[model samples]
Target: MAFVEGTGDEFILTCFVCKNPFGLVAQFCGYCQATRQQALGVERARASQQIISDEPEPQPVHNISSEVNTPAAERVKKQKPKRQNLFFQNMRLRLDNFKEWQIKRSKPIGATASALFIAFTYVVIQTYIFVNTAPTLDAEKYLYPAVTHEVSYFDASNSEPATAKTDIFPVKYLKWSASSSDRWTTKASWNGWTGKADITFTPAGNLETDRPVLAQFTAQYSTYWKVFRKITWEPASPAAILKLSYPNDKNLTIYFNGLAAGSISNPAVAAGSYQMYPGPFEIKFYNLNTGRLIDKYTRTYFISTSGVFSPSYQN
Candidate 1:
């Protein structure tokens, strides 16, 4: 490199870049306009471009066997089970939190849950006890079977059956048979329960015929139902009843089961109406003025629970 200023002289140098003669300047070649450093860089670039590169270029690293064995879709498939397991675990944790919250809500909530559990346990225990209790073949009246059944009866020489209406649900049919003088039985079976209806009669005597009477029927159970049954024992009705009108009270005296009931003539004779139970009663006729008994007859009779004794026997 050379420099000149205001010397009134012309000088020249050969350009290293273009190989042309150049006028003297401070830094650049005049012919090719290249600096010293630029010329060096261009020469190095040309030299490198001319050289033959025998070595291969670098590439990304990968396992060819692993890529072949495990495809992208198959790897994604393998990860699904793990994700599902995590989901289930999260759900269980949420459920546990919910359970804790419910139990901790209030005293009433806990108490209600405990009460329900206790009731269930009590019912289970009672069921076990009832089933395990002595198999005494106790009698039970199943309301469902009886309610669904329509029964007919013939009492005291009656020819026709009791009801004129047909059966609502004729799911069962049983033949009636006389078991004894005062009792009748029927063969009936339903819903895993099998038994006969044992009906007892009250010796019913007539108020009009005096010697003739209709039988009062009473039904009884034959077997115990030990499963899922609600039972309530009902009292048996009176076997007989006697009704006496007013004004005729003075002439009649009634006895129920050998016990003196009241006189129709008496002011306190149950308002001139005398009803009795157990049957086999006595009716005595008397004279009001003489206090002398005119006639007396003892007989056995009864009536239905809601019906008065009217001697309904027909033979």
Candidate 2:
């Protein structure tokens, strides 16, 4: 039956005419101003009184006996559980069907055909889509977003691959030379300082030049350039790496050029650095626990002589 159920207090009653809870013991429903007796099904066929009425009037006297019901709010809450259960039932059925489809797809014949299809698709995408998709970038910024190129390189003689920070806008393509002896050297002359390569953004373009330049050089020493796509350019700076050799007794906070650079979270490692210019910089180490100055030094930093900017600890 559509009706409000009253709890504990007799003075407190919920008027079915408006579904508003009222604490007044009165003859009329306080909220809807309906005759309290008629709304409670105590009387029927009373003139439909209107006094700021927002709710439907209580069921007719004749219909009240068979179809009276609880408040709409309570009915909605009771239905939520049924709806949730039905939704979960449908979801479980879908998951089971998906599992069955996966099992069938894993059968030997299907699996082999699927694997071949996937392999062929991957090769095609790599050869055509990826190759053409890797839009050529200049020494400056890469073209915006539609396509990308992640240019990296490695020497055939060396195992480690070399990459540079692409986050730098308007890059001059100068730092990547640190990876090879001549980064762009094709001369028959192979030396310790000759990067055999130069700082260049033309990772794939190097192929054309590599042939003509290395024509005189030994083919035995080879370098490979690999380019890919999709990269997020984040803000970064040229960091001056300062390696510390002395073992520390406690964690120390480092300051560079009189500004707080960072703190040594791991006291065990004596080497790390901060982002600063390559020049004379003041370094001060303070006790992380007590904030007392320990070691202070003004170290002159310069790029290492090697083509690779190998950082050495300044004593």
Candidate 3:
């Protein structure tokens, strides 16, 4: 037997074996040995049936399109746009383009700058060489003057020394003749006596035309009466026949008293007897090609009253 009890809104059952109050679903009575196996069994069977009845019925299988339309499927199918990846690709493309532009722009500029640097260096080196190696002009050779002197003479009758006729003349100008016919000439005038004399310079046997010669002469003069004289020409001036020896005659430049007197070559020689003035003078030799001085000689040339030139080198 069982009895029911209410507690608030709930109900309880009393076990008939022990008169103990219990829940409606109690399996056994605690005070008495009694079991509710039949009722429990029936309850379990009903629960199983309820569970079977609560299961959903199977439906027909659907196509993929129907599954994709579901909310869960739609959520799974959506994808985020790869904006960061696109940005990286765009950056890489821009970097590659920038590198190409840099390469293209640098080629010609680098080449031009290198070429300009090379050209500037060459110019600087050349200028340095020229400044350091160029020759300078000799001042003493260019500024000194030729030698000169004055002369006086006499022609006498053997009667008395004091009674002998005297001629007072100053011969200052001297020149070497280039013409074969006019080997040398002396001009002197004093006290209304003016004269011109021609000299013949003949070289000794087998000697070159440039060698020192034995000089002889003849003169025509106005001395109160016209006088024609033939004699050995000996003047009070010091004299010498000069010739230059050079390795390259074509390139030689000879300076006399700082003046470009003449140039010489083989087969045609520079040979002359000079009656120089009595003073310091310069003789310089140069190579015209290089604008360089080859030789420099400074001398005091003495022209005696005997009309001869004797030169001595100072250095």
Number of the predicted model whose TM-score against the real structure is largest: 1
- Which segments of candidate 1 are over 4 A away from where they belong? 1-97, 103-112, 124-183, 186-240, 244-302, 305-315
lDDT of 3 by residue, 33-82 (tens): 35655223322222222222233544657788877677883456667886
How well does model 3 score by local distance difference test?
A: 0.38
Query: lDDT (CA) for every model shown?
Result: 0.37, 0.38, 0.38
The window of 10 residues in a row where model 3 has the poorest summed lDDT is 134-143
For model 1, residues 1-315, the per-residue Cα lDDT tens digits are 455554422445544555555555436555456664443334422322332233353355899898789867766443343345888899999999999988778798878889999989867765564344321222122111221222322111122232212122112111111111232122222211111222222222222322222222222333344534322222233222344433334465544333445565553234323232222333344455675664333333433222344322111
Query: After superposing candidate 3, which stretches have Cα over 4 Å from the reference?
Result: 1-248, 266-269, 296-315
> Could you tell me every candidate's TM-score relative to the true structure?
0.26, 0.20, 0.21
Off by over 4 Å in 2: 1-160, 163-246, 266-277, 280-282, 289-292, 296-298, 303-315
lDDT of 2 by residue, 222-253 (tens): 32234322222211222223344332443767
Clashes of each: 8, 19, 20
TM-score, predicted candidate 3 vs. hidden true structure: 0.21
Candidate 2 lDDT trough over 10 residues, lowest sum: 212-221
| Superposed Cα deviation of residue 82, candidate 2 (Å) | 99
